[model samples]
Target: MVTLAEVAEHAGVSASTVSYVLSGKRSISTRTRERVERSIEQLGYHPNAGARALASSRSNVIALMMPLRTDMYVPVMMEIAIAVATSARAHGYDVLLLTGDEGPAAVRRVAGSGLADAMILMDVELDDERLPLLRDSARPAVLIGLPSDTAGLTCVDLDFVATGALCVEHLAGLGHRDIAVIGEAPAVYERHTGFAERTLEGLRGRARDLGVRLLHRPCDPGYGPTSATLARVFDERPGTTGFVVQNESAVEPLLGLLRQQGRAVPEDVSVIAVCPDQVALQASVRLTSVSIPAEEMGRRAVERIVAKLAGDDADDVTLIAPELTVRASTGNAPG
Candidate 1:
């Protein structure tokens, strides 16, 4: 095996210099770094992982804790996970995915074992059980969602409150007075998932300010539950002419049901969605939507954790602003 010493000899630099370049622990001139890299490539030198860890006191791995629940939107979660892994690789680290099934013990195991340098947690609840453990642990960590109390925690997520308000504002501007909101699963609300409740709070508060009559219903994501929820919504407020749907799974089913019920979108009732841009573009009716920025959130979370591991204090919350894209599903509310 070609060793670091051989690469250092080829590059005319010391082995410690080569180590500094690889670990980014100290500044190496661009010219020197380039020379070291070239020497490493030409010599087919691969650093021993165990030696590197011993020298750096870092495992060079990041743990990502994701929810195992089936009720959450799986596609968006998958996208975030993929983004985290990809971004971690770009930063010269690997990812360890731990499902929520392991609960707070997973946090302890990873932090205690020194198996990972840091952690990024997803699907955070308002009062998550893992928060206390994370706060007490020495390992640096970042959260992908907000919590009820953000004291001493590093968090990165979309501003769901603003996202919800943006959806309501768009509909109300289109003269949609009687509006309905299709929210996430009942279990999600019951669990007090921070984003879902925050979104609802923003929507409701803005609707009241806009003088729009708003009705909200928590729904399971599928045809049957959505159909039932839609029926109840219209039954409670028959004059409803606007909808703000936060559930991705219900988006298509809602559109299909509206068509089946003979309601012309935008011409009769306008709809706005909270989802990824891909979902909006591919929907049966192109939806005027506020995007979740899942990939961006994931990338930012990893960046924060990386910073934390590099001795930067990252204890504040980072909320990405919501962006709404105009598309086919929304128009002037019908008379």
Candidate 2:
């Protein structure tokens, strides 16, 4: 492999100048930088990751930790991955995608082994083990989800309670009374999975004020609808005239099942979902939903981390509001 020395020699510049130009340690004229870059391309000179880390005492790489599963978070994960990669590249950094199953072991391995300069964590729970490890780790890190204890870490997330209340308020204004809510299953294994449930709480609280009862059904937290779960919902709450679905994974299947049961959206069963706009758009019928700004959230998380890295005072927590997109799927309760 061609070294920086060969590229520098070919470009007629010293190795130190080439290093400075590549690291942006000291600004070289644009002309010289361009010449070095061209020489690097011609000679196929790739910077040594280990040597670079040792010389600079920093890795130009960031680790993104999430669950790499297909069911709960594929869409959201894709959004964060794209945004984080793009933003990191713009700032002269690269990303290392990691999964939740690896936990603190991932952080320890990456930072302790000089794999990355920093980390971005996702899908955090109320009491995530990674939080403490990250806090104590020498590397700077940011979280895409907030923990119950937000004492020192920087976090970025959506205001799910507000999102839920907004959905209920939107439907209530259209004169819907009896409503059915489909949400993620209550977290069973010490998971911080209350985004949907907390939103339902807000909706139910508002529903009480409006003199209406909100019927809730929690799905099994999968990528598709479970007939057994849906049947239990309908059986227990037969009077539901509208629906609020929280799981994007189950959105299509639930809609299909609803159609199979001869239910007409808006006219017979008004619907609203807490999902990304892309998912809502692909539905057989357009759905009115509280669109989660998945990409924006991810981008913002990276921005916050970069800012902190640059010695800027970053906010301890940043909450993004879900945007409501009104469509044909929601309307007045049937006569």
Overall lDDT per candidate, in order of appearance: 0.92, 0.81
Against the true structure, what is each candidate's TM-score? 0.91, 0.89
- Candidate 1 lDDT over 36-55, as tens digits, reads 99998898888887777777
Q: Any idea what lDDT model 1 has?
A: 0.92
Off by over 4 Å in 2: 27-38, 186-190, 221-225
Give me the overall lDDT of model 2. 0.81
Q: Least accurate stretch of 10 residues (summed lDDT) in model 1?
A: 48-57
Best by lDDT: 1
Best by TM-score: 1
Angstrom error at residue 61, model 2: 0.3
Q: Where is the poorest 10-residue window by lDDT in model 2?
A: 188-197
Candidate 1: C-alpha RMSD to true structure equals 2.7
85-123: candidate 2 lDDT, tens digit per residue: 998999888999898888888999998988888899887
Output the TM-score of candidate 1. Answer: 0.91
Prediction 2 TM-score vs. true: 0.89
The total of clashing pairs for model 2 equals: 0
